[model samples]
Target: MSHRPKVIAGVALAALLAGCGEQAATAPSPAASAAAPTSSAAPSAPATPVAAPDLEADPETVATGLDVPWGLAFLPDGTALLAERDTARVLRVRPGARPEQVLTVPGVEARGEGGLLGLAVSPGYEQDRWVYAYYTAAQDNRIVRFRLDGGGAPEVIFDGIAKAGNHNGGRIAFGPDGMLYAGTGDAARTATSQDRDSPNGKILRLTPDGDPAPGNPVAGSPVYSLGHRNVQGLAWDARGRLFATEFGQNRLDEVNQIDPGANYGWPEVEGTGGGSDYKDPLVTWPTDQASPSGAAIVGDTMYVAGLRGERLWAVPLGGGAPRAHFTGEYGRLRTVEVAPDGALWLTTSNTDGRGDLREGDDRVLRFPAG
Candidate 1:
């Protein structure tokens, strides 16, 4: 499909399976190897802002044998924390090292495509010592905050998001404005995408304390934007341009450059041609080629992980056609994040009940972004 000036489209498909496999071996964390900070939530070294990124180098193996690694985040000291979709465990990962269990969230019900999903450290972590999470609970999808040590029960800052076997849009991050942002699915209720009153199928903005952001479109509501099918990936460029990757139902998928209070037509319009009522996507791909999930941006380039497509996509900002990377070389790519050392990190999702599992079924890879 031609991905030129077209508009479009997060999560779908999976089953209730026990996340298997034991934790990988451990190594001293970056902090333990250096000066440990008071909080493990410090932001990683900012990815170098450049005019372009180079991804030609072969990727290096970071770690292997993970149980559906879904959410990937970095700390100021360059170590990583990841969330397993089925295991409900957060792990500490390092380069050429093994993953060690950090803490398992309590009451996480690992339903289809649900469970412990997205992870983000506080923008003010050094002071707040808080790490935020979005996950599937017994009753609904919710967001909570807690420290790594299990210091206290996770404070339920937000709740009542509809849950389902699939389409549980579960990606969360802190925007440049230091406000918490979440992409939610319609929970298979197609009509909710166009409903402003429902949080489903919307990108929501809130204070870290779980209140509606001060400048939300509604005076006291959390709906930053509505009409998304299932948003699974969120990232921002150097200019603070927020972009999201969404899962389309059958025909099209999208990478949208987000605007405040904008409507991304879903259920109403799949790809483009929504007219003035909805904002079109910056790029669109056939569903077969881009079930785009986790997204990370470096310089002027965006890297999106493709789950069913089994590849990584490099999308350039200046009217450049997106190029594919490692197509089918890594099966079912699930998560992508820019590491503190300025490398692109990707996680494979072979063990996520869909792909043909390899010897090292689920793994993480690092590629140069310089």
Candidate 2:
């Protein structure tokens, strides 16, 4: 569960089923929103199919020849800020210019999954010029804030979190509420995913200053939800519904609708199943098919980046479970983000030492959101 290179730890029974079980399962609690439908049964009636437009019949490459681009954040001016995992450098990409190394962060451990991972611009970027990043430090995975101006030093905001070489959860974004939300890996410890006291393997809600949000389930705790493995992606729909993509252990990879105080089965459960206390995944994929990474929501569709699956998946977001749209075209897609132009930009990760790289390995490509 811990993204780092470590061994799995034992699970704590109380935390494992905390607020999840028969009593909570029957009731429609706020936490129930995190459950995903796993049934193979067909719907009673087929809804009118909405045709998806061809965003990119031939997807064109935007940037190329990178070490391993892990995270991407778009500026208001249409340029992009990219994080290269192994290099610990942040590159700026503009429409008609070459990529430029704007900043090189120090103290980043470039082991397995421990490096510069996710990036996000502040909601008040015009005034603050703040950029947030998730990376592995010598002690643990931490979140830091930095000014966009070159040579500005990073100020540590959150620290003392569990870190693994592989499952380090590293996605960070600003919610509509102006609060910062972070998705963390389990740190190779299964019980940590369910521990409210532990920041590992959980979705955290915090203020811009990295303080725990006021309305969290537990006072003074930033944990939004628990029992997650390696949560790589987070997105919000037009209706403000939060969704996340998590890497599975061996059987099922998952996409879940996240709700405050929700508990997702990790060491106890993997895919969808009937449970009174815990929430199920809205969608499940074989681990090989969907090592899902970053996600972006557009209109009624959720576009997810597939790492091992090597494809872009379009999950219909009309309120039910997600179904795969397309599979196996691009190789090792790592990040999927909605650009300011309304197009979806996907970054490839084949060069990240995980998969086989092709002719244009480690590139950023753009596609229309059909």
Candidate 3:
């Protein structure tokens, strides 16, 4: 894909605002210290596999025979849309039926951890029949919108996001305010995470037309917050608190309560430290147990997907820090989304060139939360 001039413009803008001081740094609580390692060589025990919780027992497979399925979104009428990263295909799946390819998008740069990654149904999907996606094009990772016409071409709504092979964050969701929100990565440039002017490492809030949403933290820009490395998952709880899952640099992975305009430390800090300006993560896990990807919130609990950790983490959340309930059940959990029937739908990433692949390497699993 050709490099769009807008991407360079965005980078220039980011460089101008990269001088902001780090903010809101608090020491990680003792609980957080116990969950995550303090240094790179900290001796930590391997995560033990636990029995499938009763709520997750009898998880019926929704789809099979897929290649690196990354994200899933359900239509208003109950059909599902899934994105296959390497294949560059968007599939429409009906219950108990074969998945049909809706469209094969072009301009995908399937390199390393980058590819077609996240998908979301438009907030007005019942009327518009539009689906939004985040993918790595040849030049950059971008978010685009398309109509879900089976076997037809997808109309590109927007393009020119920052892209990198490893930290190409690609999770998108429509927030409660009827606006689209995208989580972006820093494209291997750590300073970009702290650059408020850049869209690369921020939570972007935009209208359906891809314009900046009203009352954004940055006037005339879609950025809601700054200082993020690679945010891959976004979800809202019943209480309307937004949460995001982040990939840590080396030692710590995090789940944070996303506050608008907040600064989350990236290059300056890893797990937790004291600086008084950067916001500390509410929960941190060792990178080995929680290279988290996607997340879903049901009731007071948050279900997070782990890529390298090879587990599905159940975190109970209310106000204080989140607590881990279960770890290491399904290997390499990739995506977790709330289903219409109230069950949490999850996908695996073992076949995504990251880990060992067993029989039924990549399949969708459902866990009904009681």
For each candidate, the alpha-carbon lDDT, in order, equals 0.78, 0.76, 0.72
lDDT of 2: 0.76
Per-residue alpha-carbon lDDT of candidate 1 for residues 13-79, written as tens digits (9 for 90 to 100): 0111111111111111222112211212212344345533456777788888999999888877888
C-alpha lDDT of candidate 1 relative to the true structure: 0.78
The clash count for each model shown is 5, 20, 9
lDDT of 3 at 279: 67
TM-score of each: 0.86, 0.85, 0.84
Q: Can you write out model 3's per-residue Cα lDDT over 4-41, one digit (the tens) per residue?
A: 21222344343333222322222224343223222122
TM accuracy, model 2? 0.85
Candidate 1 has a TM-score of: 0.86
Ranking by TM-score: 1, 2, 3
With candidate 3 superimposed using the best TM-score fit, by how many Å does residue 230's alpha carbon deviate from the native?
0.4
Under the 3 Å rule for N, CA and C atoms, how many clashes does model 2 have? 20
lDDT of 2 by residue, 88-126 (tens): 999997655778998888889989988998999997898
Off by over 4 Å in 1: 1-48, 51-54
> Which ranges of candidate 3 are over 4 A from the true structure?
1-56, 150-153, 319-329
